[model samples]
Target: MAVLRVSPAPVPAGRRQDRLSTARPPAKLQISAGAHAADPLLSLPDLPTPLKEKILCMEMMGIDSGRALSLNPALRSTPLDSLHVIISFLLTKGIHHKDLARIFGMCPAALTAEPRRDLAPVFNFLAAELAVPSAAFRRVINKCPRLLVCSVPDQLIPALVFLKRLGFKDMEGLAYHDPVLLASSVEKTLLPKLEFLEREVGEGKEMVVRCPALFTFSVENNLRPKLGYLVEEMGRDVAEVREFPQYFAFSLEKRIKPRHRAMEERGLRLSLPTMLKTTDHEFGLLLQTADSSPTVGP
Candidate 1:
């Protein structure tokens, strides 16, 4: 049999020098080329690959999530309209969680980080820019609301109050608090003010809130736990909150005990998850169980 002659495929002009070099290139260079060109899910400079992947994956999925795509530290610093646009985009995408990871670059563990994905930053940005009044926010959120994830009690209160102040009465579909944030800020004087805001807002609707359905005591310093006892207390009277099942946490820390107490009296429990769950059957609450020993403390 005749031997077949083999020849090397023609190399691109740009790659000839690379092929001639005997020294191995650095991993960083290889990664750069592989990531920038070959990998659509590559991470940018200064951000972890996971985070970069998380953000882009969410965006690629068209989820209307928040600013998971942004790289500038300064841009990340402010929750502005740009951030809102990003969030809205991600949310609208409604991408599946697993697909989100595959498209962007987030691991399952990273996706579980509630704080990093919290919408409070975006709300704060909206509140500042849109001047979301208590009544208007209530009205808008109530009309087409989205529930927030569970967080700390203290952290969640401020956002709830802010939403209330803006007219977002759809308490049934709001974000919850983070326990870590709550345990930190629970005992502060802000409790009374927060309660008061709720009462004041609820009173306008002719609804009576009977007990501090959502209450907290500082676990440490300013951190507070977003306790379910508060909602349980309110469930006694109000038609909506009376049957709420789970509890949630909040992001901001502001005291409003007197206000909270008053709302409780009206049967208006303000546990974000409880309200959301009551409104939408799908917006269920997830009460975190206590470990044998406290896993989290202020």
Candidate 2:
């Protein structure tokens, strides 16, 4: 080939830069120097950087970001010493990391609570006064972390006293099954619910202890209607209801009424739980089988 020199394409006047400027690239996220300085987390020199970042990341990614942000001021106000104390004390109480994360995530305010004033008293009360076992204490606190922040004398003590007076002898059962009961209003919630249950099934505390779940059911909607059907309409005794207090949990329209009607029409006798717990198709099949069976004259 002929040694012909080929010229390169000309660069546009504005585009050519032989030497690049030694300047920092513009930041994708612009934050003021004052903001970095004023951050409360940064002000605490003792706080581990990883922990600080974890808290901030958790707040940003929380289910309710606005609520998390609103809570940040409270969190920032908490002394690092207090936060550490709370965490350490909880760990000592046998709470696992996953449970602690879940509890703190749900009630972030608990992290800001004073370990001595807010948390220690509750733990002491649960362990010493209520005699809640370590494992049971962890379970209760995990289920109702709000209990950590509740007033020991005013709220927790009163509720426990009320339940005790109500003959709740199984403290372990209360702790594991319905620790939220400890946080409930004695006058407003617990008393009212107990009164309703007593009115329906007589003043036997054993019934309540047998079915602690009775406290969780709705009095007006579920309990009353179902009790009315079973006791008033079906003529089942309070003793029967007391034996199977879970009957109050069934849906009056969907389960109780339909099943009771089918059983009554077929003259079939079945336990309350069996009748209500079975599916509609199962109930229908039960009715068909009962009808097909020959009746023996007694």
Candidate 3:
């Protein structure tokens, strides 16, 4: 009976059409969490089998995997031929394979660096200007690889010139003991330390040459405190400290103070080495014997 009025309710204006049109196909959800992540090692081009083996060998020789991997990019950019040349040149210079591996492990950049542009000048300066004997070259470079990268005019030459001014004519000794001095800052490190020794202790280049190890010690921590203790506290002469500069190398808290205090209490005046170099057991024995000994009346 109501068929005449059973027509579907009039469609709302644009409702059905809007619903139909607005309904979009499910979007392809793209998660890029790990999909696009880069591999650190993959960024480097594949290395030759031999090269890969060599790197593995280096890792076995105490170079960490991360460091060895980090070197890959530089190695990739550097031609295999260039690496061979560098290795060959170093070998010709008397650097053994084991030493070469150690050096390269320590300074991977040297493996990729330009031989003539980056390394040759340093070698030349050491051999010719500094008179570092060819026989000792490998040993010195092994000790301080930074010498290969340091600037001749800026860093190395100035240090050499200053050392020469300080009567350091024995380049072989300097290269062996303090090649790091060639890589240190002339204005900042070398100058201030030299000035401190000179001004405070009447020590100069001669003292430094005698004990190149002095350059390796810190002025604020090792040199100043030890010198002050010996001079002001102990009333030791400046010349005495200069004569036994190795005293500065001993630990102030552990070795110097304890030994000095023991010696002072016992009225003993032993050489610096003897005073500080003894083992704990030996030192304790000395202290015990000193305590038990008769006190001589002055």
Candidate 4:
């Protein structure tokens, strides 16, 4: 039972008024060696009966518990600066920079760059105060969407790849919603066509495209049933005025919902869904899903 002694001096004139009344005088105590054997031993100043009792109650506990016991306004006689260390030390156990970033609506890469001498001590105190990893006791944090905000246009490709690595697979649709990043690249004419394709076809667990543009080319056996087709006899019809590509294709295995399935599956056996859809709307949503759900937990 090693004992610790705490001696608190009077708070300076300018600072003491902010956290506590300055009416209280400074304290000095000559504690017994027997009392010092306790984990937390306090030397007290001239104080009222109630205040003295509170300080005694805190000193009875060990150092870690003593700080907690002293949290009460009546028992906390430590100066404001000392209290700052105690608070920071105790708080460090519960929070880390990542958590702070989430709370502040910013990315971990965006923490303030200011230098600080006191910050190091506070950080060290916190580390010592909370040796346990906070992640062990808490659920994993959700990835923030704000990180995807990009000012540089070229970052779209790498950003998408990075997001995929981080388990955000269904992000193609978000490109339309976001003001930055890939969303900006989607032209007004092309965006809605993508969205209509998604809504009409039902995105990619099952996909099919059919058109008469490639009459003689041998269709892959695996993809034939998924094809959408228009009759060749209607070549001169207004619907066929739009030029068809050398081959009509469908992206068959996507993860988004509500659209982007095969034309055959959706009965959209049209000559030019792209041209027709594109003329009607400027921008559309393209949603792609991942093969598996995200992993989340502590």
Candidate 5:
């Protein structure tokens, strides 16, 4: 209901003792945001009172009411009080009022989700299992808003357990830096990547631990082409990769190919670090030095 609040009138000095005892705290008023209430979104003919309140509250919180409604149609049926409860629950979790716009804008369905059943468990897992301090909850949640929607037992825990079993040592690092990996599905996203490493790069299974960025790469797009060029084209042994797992971090088309071509043009066979670690000008200096006694590839 739309409320109109008024503060108590000033009491005369002589009657201060009598009136002050009866005076209560001033009533707080909450008005919806945006233009005048008579605007069409709010003033639509015969709009239900609860939904009107929901839209008003959403606008007041800086959320795009239209997008949030489309993303979570349940907003129409959910009570205004329930929406407030969800906001209050998130605030208790260290998500500030300023953070609400981005969070709700990204996962608008969150506004309608059950606070204790659906949401609280994720927070509990972060605090109890991942060891995320309550003060740092905002940092983790903001890093991956999907954490707000993912289930504790079903999605997050299984992935965390899998990463741990695979020798992931930094629990706090994963929670704080890569919570998306935890939010990901084990069967769909994480497992297939590990399986690929076990089958294809069997000798260097531990390389992923040495270089976690390998998880972000695609087998077909990045790993396959680079490995193919290294072995089939350049005739280099795969052990070079085991020695420097950061080999995968370089660009195949830009840095790797150009530098390899420079070495080949000079008919010089340099070590992987010799080829990859130097700056462009330094590599030019190396090539100049190599040109004097260039060795032919056999």
Candidate 6:
């Protein structure tokens, strides 16, 4: 049987190889030598590999990447290592990782803060100047994370000094509990509130130092309206308010006005503490049991 020598498959092997080589394979993605592979779905902004790493890193830390990035443009160029430094530095200062999420969320500047110049001196001032114990560092910082980004000489030291001058005896308590005072401006915030109270009550300095929370209140929205209700509406003297300065601490609309109205309706006049301090149920009980003859006593 004659073996039909089948013709060499379509073309010569060399020609087939030539055709395969000449015909271009589908176009490829040209990634740089050290660049990361692009995300498959979205063509993201052209960001440096390290910067993208920083964003991912911060997002993992529970910071709002969009807000933080927008508020702090420095983050664009901030080295990934710089973020790590800030994170590590805060952790060293007794700040928990969870706490860092809240802290940096509030003040993104802290995410890029210099470890020594910006941060170290804060603890130094807390320890040496303010005499805040090392252990209380976390409590103080967690109380006010803005402390980390503040200038030691410009903000913290001056605020502490001002408070001390005003006879704030419980420095530790102020640092931990009412830290927003330290962040407050002596001229813009603390002093103005004090002056307003002095004008109204004639004992502003003593009252505020006695109850530092007065500084946190809005003079326009809080102090003025509450004092107005106390003097003009309640027919009480400023001296009476001086005795219970925390009267400003309670919500005028929610607690003070309603309770005071409830008292007037029942003809039961209670002291500020007696009226304001009691719960709704207690205040109701007070209205029921107290002499309906309006027993007004400081």
Candidates ranked by lDDT, best first? 5, 6, 3, 2, 1, 4
lDDT of 6 by residue, 136-217 (tens): 8988888888888878788877888888888888877887788888888888998899889888899887898878889999
Give the clashing pairs for model 2.
none
- Quality of model 4 by C-alpha lDDT: 0.32
Model 3 ranges off by over 4 Å: 1-62, 68-81, 231-239, 271-274, 277-289, 292-298
Q: What is the C-alpha lDDT of each candidate?
A: 0.36, 0.70, 0.72, 0.32, 0.80, 0.79
In the range 1-298, model 2's lDDT, one tens digit per residue, is 0111223445545654532244333324222332332245334468665445445444433324345437656764455466567778888888875676578767777877777788889988888866787777777888888888899999998998988988888877777778888888888877888888777678546766777777777678777777778878777777777878777767778778877787777778787767777787887887887788735111
lDDT of predicted model 2:
0.70
Off by over 4 Å in 4: 1-106, 112-176, 179-298
By TM-score, rank the candidates, best first.
6, 5, 3, 2, 1, 4
Q: Write the per-residue lDDT of candidate 3 for residues 1-298, one digit (tens) a residue.
A: 0001112334457586775587633323222223222222223346564455445334444455467458656664455467668878887877887786568767777767777887888888988886777887799889987677687888899998988888888876787878898889888888888899999888767788888778878888889888888878777787877777777888888888888887788876666666777798987877777778746211
TM-score of each: 0.21, 0.67, 0.68, 0.15, 0.69, 0.82
In terms of lDDT, model 3 sits at 0.72
Candidate 4 Cα deviation (angstroms), residue 76: 31
In candidate 2, clashing pairs total 0
Better of 3 and 6 by lDDT: 6
Query: Number of clashes in every candidate structure?
Result: 100, 0, 0, 25, 0, 0
Q: Is candidate 2 or candidate 5 better by lDDT?
A: 5
Tell me which of candidates 1 and 5 scores higher on TM-score: 5
Question: By TM-score, how accurate is candidate 4?
Answer: 0.15
Q: What's the true lDDT of residue 72 in model 6?
A: 90
